[model samples]
Target: MNYDTVRSVDPAVADALEAEVDRQGDTLAMIASENHVSEAVLEAQSSVLTNKYAEGYPGSRYYGGCEHADTVEQLAIDRAKELWGAEYVNVQPHSGSQANMAVYTAMLEPGDKILSLDLTHGGHLSHGHPKNFAGQVYEVENYEVDEESGRIDFDEVRAHAEEFDPDMIVSGFSAYPREVQWEEFQAIADDVDAYHLSDIAHITGLVAAGVHESPVGVADFVTGSTHKTIRAGRGGIVMADEEYGDAIDSAIIPGTQGGPLMHNIAGKAVGFQEALQPHFEEYAEQTLKNAQALADHLQDHGFSLVSGGTDNHLVLVDLRDSHPNVTGKEAEEALEDVGIVLNANTVPGETRSPFVASGIRAGTPALTTRGFDEDACETVGHCIAEVIDNPDDEDVKAEVAEIVTGLCEEFPLYDDDTEGLVFE
Candidate 1:
């Protein structure tokens, strides 16, 4: 983990890398989209395979010296297939967004219509946000969560799908805390004759472990981030029936990306192997339990959670009723200062801009990876509520910082070796 050679050659780069390691070690990462990969996965991601330019799929690369590349890539593909039960898997998209792009480019033409959830209501930008390439290339419409329930309004979605008659309907989310009804989404897509691309980017691990429902056999295409809840290093993946395999492979290769991130694929292989262990199921279950603890404790503290609760690993706290004056950014900053790091997120019916949203999103994947149990998570929830409620209070922050420090020490991330390197 020490960047010794880099430090000898470029101390400046080494210093920043060391600082990042320190940052992750010292602070709690509560971002719903983030997780801590195993040391083996980290080592794989930093492997020498990064030097290779296997500009095509395994055993069929445009370049020579793809033997090792073929071995690692096939392992990733096979492991992914075993994990998700997809007839075909593409481990070359580089990111979840790119995975979505591969599906879109492969299945639909330019100016094709897309129906997706609103970004403020938990949908991802890659689904159809105006700032993203999907929005620029596709005619997009959005469905929303029920204003009162904070769950997807299936009737409303069906109505919009019928009206828009989209070519595809994106069925995954970014900050949503509920277990999505992929079958229901497939029904709507089927009714409207639209393809369903279920982007289980956040719940990749949960879905893989069967803690969450599988979309692989239900949706027309399933896409996800290899990181996040999966802890498979950082990359993207696409899964589909064998029918669309060739198109997706083509889309990924000459379409959305050049060569795959082979090193990250190796990491994915290692992480997927780790996930295949019986313990990963326990870890996935614990992740959800910890999230429920956070949600329950926050609600107990008088905070309002969108959806009222959670079925997955994140809780979206809408501050509108509990602390109308406090913005999500303020809450995020306050929590970060106290060493509890999460993110500002848009709640349903948000009146504020995305930058200063009305809600905060926190998740348990990283904490659970650090071995946080429900009790520890409940304590984290208390610290978060205290800080969010009393952002300007040094006394509150100091008090919360102690709790965070204690938790970090009790569930230390990384080892005592190179990770003990100083930040500043």
Candidate 2:
């Protein structure tokens, strides 16, 4: 686990790497889909396991001398099963999108209808976006969130399911702030005889820590990312009921990716172990609290929040009514100038394009992981509101930047005091 390489072969690349770390240390990352992984996870990700080429599963590899690789991969599998209470786990897909692709390939035929949430309405690209492979292969029918409530209308979803009669029903979101009703989706799937697949990539950490509802028992297949709120390396996992274990594993191995990244699997094992600890529950709870606090603060400051608030770690601010002059692009740029990082996102009935959305999505997972709490979240929210309210005001942006820097200092991401903490 040699994590001490400071210089790159190219001086320009080395400078960029160092600069990126400084940027991360100084900026307030409000991106809902990002988080700071622990040192233990980082060590595993940069470990010697990168040298291995173990193409197959444990004890059944096509290559030789994979004793340690087998141990690491199996550990990830076992821990994921334990964490999610799934009958089987496949920690091989390169990303959450790939995991979902494998699941689709394993069960559905080309041109088979699939019901998923619309991408602009809080769904992911892998969930049948026209440009994604899922849409190219399957006939995708999309359900949308209610415009008034900004929440999923189960009745609407059920109506779509009944009409579409999809082979699979995909449930998950990348920007949705409310809780997903898994049982409702499951019942709808049952009625349509569709397989229920829950992509919990964004909320796996909360589900693992028991802060959010688990979709494992209800969904036939569950796909998640190792990063995001899980605070692991960049990788994907697919967990399924016992009946689909063989098919899902085969789909991931032969149908989608060729070889697995053993190093990331090792990191996933460490992340799962951390998630199993009781303190991880505290972390998940704090993440939710910080999100709610930020949402309330923004609302109090006269910013209209989509869905009115958040039940999870992210919030979507509808700038259409709050700051009609400020586009999502302008707000994001203004926040970036002040060292606050968040992505521009589309609202439920967005009139603007995806690239230039009508809303900004913000979250507290990364900052909370860095030790920022409810009070800090409120301050951060105020900073964001100030920037959006006065995007052209350089003085206001400077003030917010100073405040964000002060908050970062208070909540150091990597403390020097615990430099060598290892996982047993």
Candidate 3:
């Protein structure tokens, strides 16, 4: 991928852009929240639509020359509805957090109470972490996973909701490995008379492919990122029954965001179309298989996994048990040095600072996109175990790096002849 056009205009930015593509091509991206969008999706995002500002939804735009914007946005909304079987879909909000913000803005007033999963127990910052807007505006309480089982206990969540009497209840999570029981959360919300907002940000693609349970018809509202498992580029979407459609639209447009990212919506359209193909389901199923394979391989090497394993695309390894002296940060750095990239995450019963948490979260989405199967994931898992087991061993790192280079070559990201944005 050559960046000749960019180099002609700005050589420095061009070099950085080219270097990034090289880095992605060379490393294994195991971050649970990341995936590689198709080249088609990338091109759509880099389109001229970025120049246009469509201030309103589809037909009722507040700006002129929105014909193309309307077409792309409508296609994105329609495709999202088809993918998730939602009665209404909004493909706007800049990110999953903003999508959650729109829902909160539409349904609750300031000081309204929100009940959600605890952050360290697999929740997101937008659900009401102290540093985020939701936390500042709403009175929030959190429920946690059972430390013994490393899974959410619905009874505990119900009890927390009853005690908190929150106006809204959030379901779905970030670091959790088990399948979320959408019905259980919906029931809890019903019992408490609270609005249920299920944020399926990390598993949007899995849900679309029917590999994971969907929250669309079960919850009062559903929000997801267009990237992550979906590979739709960087954006967010909100879905609901038609009853709340107008409120959601208004909240997103006048309340949270202004003009929609029309280019990103185009990417969403293309990616959603790609997902609709039959191969996407095969991809989703393989993603789960690969995660399980990695989990088993890690366990074989004596790593303790949260929930004992994974039912989804990610597995969270608690370093405290297997390697008491190793922090998740140290494991992350060591693995990155050998080209296996993931993240340090806080575990269910975390005792250390979030930055130096005792667990690592790894996933199979991007690797699966790069054509990795169960066997390939196990190979990567073995490499991860080796690096973490002997983080200070230079010979081990060299061996792992060589294996990573071989794997990267075996599963090339882009064609050799593909020009534009190529790094040296």
Per-residue accuracy of model 3 over 87-160 as CA lDDT, tens digit each: 99999989999999999999999999999989999999999999999999999999999998999999999999
Looking at model 3, residue 292 earns an lDDT score of 98
For candidate 3, what is the TM-score?
Answer: 0.98
Off by over 4 Å in 1: 417-424
94 Cα displacement, candidate 3 (Å): 0.5
Mind giving the per-residue lDDT tens digits that candidate 1 earns over 1-424?
A: 5689999999999999989887898899999999988878888999999999999988899999999999999999999999999999999888999999999999999999999999999999999999999999999999999989999989999999999999999999998889999999999999999999999999999999999999999999999999999998698999999999999999988997887889989999999999888889999999999999999999999999999999999999999999999999999999999898899999999999999999999999999988899999999998998898899999989999998988888887776743521111
Which one wins on lDDT?
3
RMSD of each: 2.7, 1.8, 2.3
lDDT of 2 by residue, 1-424 (tens): 1223555356776677667767887888899999988888988998999998988789998899999999988989898888889888999888999999989989999999889999899999999988998898899989999988999999999988888889999999998999998999999999999999999999999998888999998888899999898887789999888889888878877778777899999989988888888778898999999999999999999998889999999999999987988899989999999999999999999999999999999988898888888999999989999999899999998898899889878876555655522322
> What range of 10 consecutive residues in model 1 has the weakest lDDT sum?
415-424
TM-score of each candidate structure, all chains considered together:
0.98, 0.97, 0.98
Query: Model 1: C-alpha RMSD to truth?
Result: 2.7
Report residue 43 deviation for candidate 1 (angstroms): 0.9
